[model samples]
Target: MITALSHPFFLHALLAGTAIALASGLVGYFLVLRAQTFTGDTLGHVAFTGAMAALAGGYDLRLGLFAATIGVALLLGALGRRGRPDDVVIGTLFSWILGLGTFFLTLYTTHRSSTQGNAGITVLFGSIYGLDATQTTTAVLIAAGITTAVLLLARPLLFASLDEAVAAARGVPATALGLGFLALAGACAAEVTQAVGSLLLLGLLAAPAGTAIRLTDRPYRALGLSAALAVLDLWAGLALSAQVPVLPPSFSIMAVTATCYAAAHLVGP
Candidate 1:
């Protein structure tokens, strides 16, 4: 494993994974608190659609993923009058994006001459080992930006998330904070797509946060524990993947995260 660390791809994956874990931990705490797990899952589908669309249009897949997810995040925020987004609106968007993803998949498969039939699979499951230096840098920068934004909004966002009516009555911009947090969540989703892929992203985003919440009632401590667990998940997954080359890193990561969550649940609060 030490020898593998010398490899550029391994190094990139480590850095990128760490950044993603940190961002996911922070954003996910609020995602769980806001009960927006479904929203995060929907964003994964949107990310898949965007990446497919980019491939079909001969653009960078990352661009498509970021643009589509962030746009949807902002739209959801705007449609939401209060901190709580309208479930009906989210349902509508969810169906539309899934349909769009199907269309893009068909378009990509038909027009593309590339023999890589697994391209779509890669988008769905991720190809973290394939991340180049530029992609790693991009993921790290985006993660940093998302983390900083979450920190800046932490206090009010917490107030808004814990009690929307009370926070609004107390003059907190609950609506605005909700929107901003969703936007950050979107960005975090995009960043994580590089590490675990879209399909398995929810595990990475929610598991650590879920475990942390079960273990502690203190918000800051929960956030810290979430980040630490996420980092451990990624590192363990990577190490296991290295030891067993047949396993996909994304699957390994998700498996580790899921196992940890199960263990946490078993232990109880």
Candidate 2:
């Protein structure tokens, strides 16, 4: 295990995965508190469509997905402010984009180069072994930004989440908090897609936080435990997958997270 950390690829992958897990847990805690669990699944699928378009258009898939995800996040925030049910819109939009993805996927299938097709798979299922130094650095930067923002706004965000009506009355700017959290979550989803793929992003994103929240009520403890569990789930999954060679890393990671959540639920209030 110690030697594994020294290997270049393993080191980079570990770095990227750790940062991605931290950000996911932080943002996801707020997401659970705010009742935005659906946003994770929704933004993840949106990334899928953006990645497909990027594949067809010759752009960087991550950037394309990030841009599209941010746009969707902002739009959902606006819709929520206007009293629309964002999840309903998101649910409808998910199928629409997925349909578009399938159509383009079929279009690409006829003559798509294998390299381009592999990019599509990367978006769908992630490629941890493929992470490079630059990508790892980017993940770290994003994680740092997320941590800073969440720390600064945690109280207001929490206040709004626990009691929105009271928070709104207390000048907590609940709508702004909601939009901010959504935007943060969108960016975190984009980062997580780097490690776990869009399909299982929610599992990694929501599970740790959900479990942590159930185990504790204090803000700091909840966020800290969530991040720690996320790191455990992904890193253990990575190591186990490397050793076992039966299950895929992405699914294995999610399984670990789901098990944690289930354990927390079983020991419930």
Candidate 3:
């Protein structure tokens, strides 16, 4: 374990993973609290589609990733009542996004597969260990930006999530906060896609937040605890994968996350 720290790849994974986990924890807590877990899940499909679109268009994957997720998030806000994305809005978009993803996948596989065959796979399952120095730095910066934005919006967002009607009545700008949070969540989903891939994005986002919520009824405490648990899950998963090279880091990390969530259910309030 200590030996892995000296390696550049492991160090990069650790740093980037920690930053992503922090943002996921913060944003994910609100996602769960607001009953917006489905939105987060839908964004995973959006992430995959976006990446495929980028690949098909020969653009940078991040360009497609962020543009698609953020664009759809804003669209969801626009389509829903008071900027709060409801089940109907999310469900309607979900299948369309998946179909679009399929179209892009066909384009990529048919044309660019010879050159970038694994690109789609990378977006779906992640390639954290494959990150180079520049990618790692970029991931960390994006995660930091996301974390900062979520923190700034945390309080009002909390109020809005808990009770949109009351929050708007109290002049809390519920609509704007909801829109802002969805956008933040979109960005967070895009960032998480890089670390854990879209397949397990919800696990990283939900499990820690779910565990934290189970452990405490205090909102702020659960928020912080969510972030802490996510970081620990990332660290433990990475360490385990490092010790046992046969294990995939994403699977290991999510396994730890699942275990913690289950433990929370067993031992928590």
Residues 99-166, candidate 2: write the lDDT tens digits: 88877666665556665556667788987768889888988898889878887998888888889999
- Whole-model lDDT values for every prediction: 0.89, 0.83, 0.91
Q: Which tens-of-lDDT digit does each residue in 55-162 have in candidate 1?
A: 889999899999988988888877776555566778888888889888988888888857455778888999989999998998999898998998889899999988
Arranged by lDDT with the best first, the candidates are 3, 1, 2
- Specify the highest-lDDT model's number: 3
> 14-46, model 3: which lDDT tens digit per residue?
999999999999999999998889889999999
What does the lDDT read for residue 161 in candidate 1?
A: 88
> Deviation in angstroms for 47 in model 2?
0.8
Highest-scoring model, TM-score: 3
* Superior by TM-score: candidate 2 or candidate 3: 3
| TM-score: model 3 vs. ground truth | 0.96
- Candidate 1 or 3, higher TM-score? 3
Better of 1 and 2 by lDDT: 1
In order of appearance, the predictions have TM-scores of 0.95, 0.93, 0.96
